[model samples]
Target: MIKIYHNPRCSKSRQGLSILEASGKEFEIIKYLEKELTSKELLSIISKLGIKPMDLIRKNEAIWKSEYKGKTLSDQEIIEAMLKHPKLIERPIVINEDKATIGRPPENILNII
Candidate 1:
C-alpha cells in the first residue's frame, strides 16, 4: 500500500495529495504533525529514501533555523529533533513498498508509486 506523511496546511502537501488522488491508487494518509513519527520510524524512512537524515529535513522551517542550524548533529540527533518539531520534516513523504520519496515536486511520488 502507498502511505503518505502529510501536512494538510502545506500547499505542497495538498498538491501531493491531489496527485495521489489522480493516480487512483489506494493510499494511507498520515497527519505527521498530529501523529509524529518515532526515531526508529524516521530512520527506516531515511533508509528507504536512500538519503541521509539531513536530506529529509525542512531546513527552511524556523524550528530548524532557530534551534538546529549549523549544529553538528548525529543521525539520531536529527531524527529526535524532527520528532520534537514535526514541522521540520519535509512535507509529503510518500512510501510504496520498500521505496520512498519526499514529494517536493509532488511528481516525485509518481516514480515510487
Candidate 2:
C-alpha cells in the first residue's frame, strides 16, 4: 500500500496529494501533525527513505531555528525533536512498500508510486 505523510496547509504537500489523486491508485494519507508518529515509526520511515534522520527534518521551521539549529545532535536526538515538534518534519513523505521519498518537488512521488 502507498502512504503519504501529509500536511494540508502546505502547498507542496497539497500538490503531492493532488498527484496521488490523479494517479487513481489507492493510497493512505497520514495527517502527521494531527496524529503524531512514534519514534519507532519515524525511524522506520527514515530507514525506508534511504536517508539519515536529519534529511527528513524541515530545518527552516521556526521551531528548528529557535531550538535545534546550531546544535550538534545524534540521530536519536533529531528524531526526538521531530517527535516533540511534528511541524519540524518535512511534508508529503510518500511510502510504497519498501520504497519512499520526500516529496519536496511533488513529482518525485511519481517515480516511487
Candidate 3:
C-alpha cells in the first residue's frame, strides 16, 4: 500500500493526493497536522526519504523563519523542531513499500509509485 504524509491545505499536497487517487492504488493518508507525528515516525520518514533532516524542512514557512532561522542546529535538533512544528515539514511525502519520494513538482511521485 502507498502512504502519503499530507497537509490538506497545501496545494502541492492536494495535487499529490490527486495523483495517488487517479492511480487507483490502495493508500493511506497521514494528516500530519491533525494527527502529529512522533519523533520516531519523523526519523523513519527522513531515513526513507534518503535526505538530510534539513532537506526535509519547509524553510520558507513563517514558523521556521521566526523560530529556527539563522541558527545552527544539529540533525536531531532539526528533527525536534519539525516534530514541535509539523507545518515546518515539507509536504506530500509518498511512500511505497521501502521507497519514498517528496512530491515537490508532485510529478516526482510518479517515479516511485
Model 1 lDDT-worst window of ten: 35-44
lDDT by residue (25-98, candidate 1, tens digit) is 99999998888788788888889999988888989988899999999999889888888998988989999999
- Candidate achieving higher TM-score, 1 or 2: 2
Reference-based TM-score of each model: 0.96, 0.98, 0.98
Candidate 2: deviation at residue 68, Å? Answer: 1.0
Candidate 3 per-residue lDDT, tens place, 1-113, comes to 89999999999999999999999999999999999899999988999999999999999999999999999999999999999999999999999999999999999999998
Best by lDDT: 3
Model 2: lDDT of residue 69: 94
Deviation of model 3 at 27, angstroms: 0.3
Model 1 score (lDDT): 0.91
- Superposed by TM-score, candidate 2 places the C-alpha of residue 66 at a distance from the truth, in angstroms, of 0.5
- Give lDDT per model, in order: 0.91, 0.94, 0.95
Model 1, residue pairs in steric clash: none
Model 2 gets an lDDT of 0.94
Task: Identify the superior model by lDDT, candidate 1 or candidate 2.
Answer: 2
Evaluated against the true structure, the overall lDDT of model 3 is 0.95
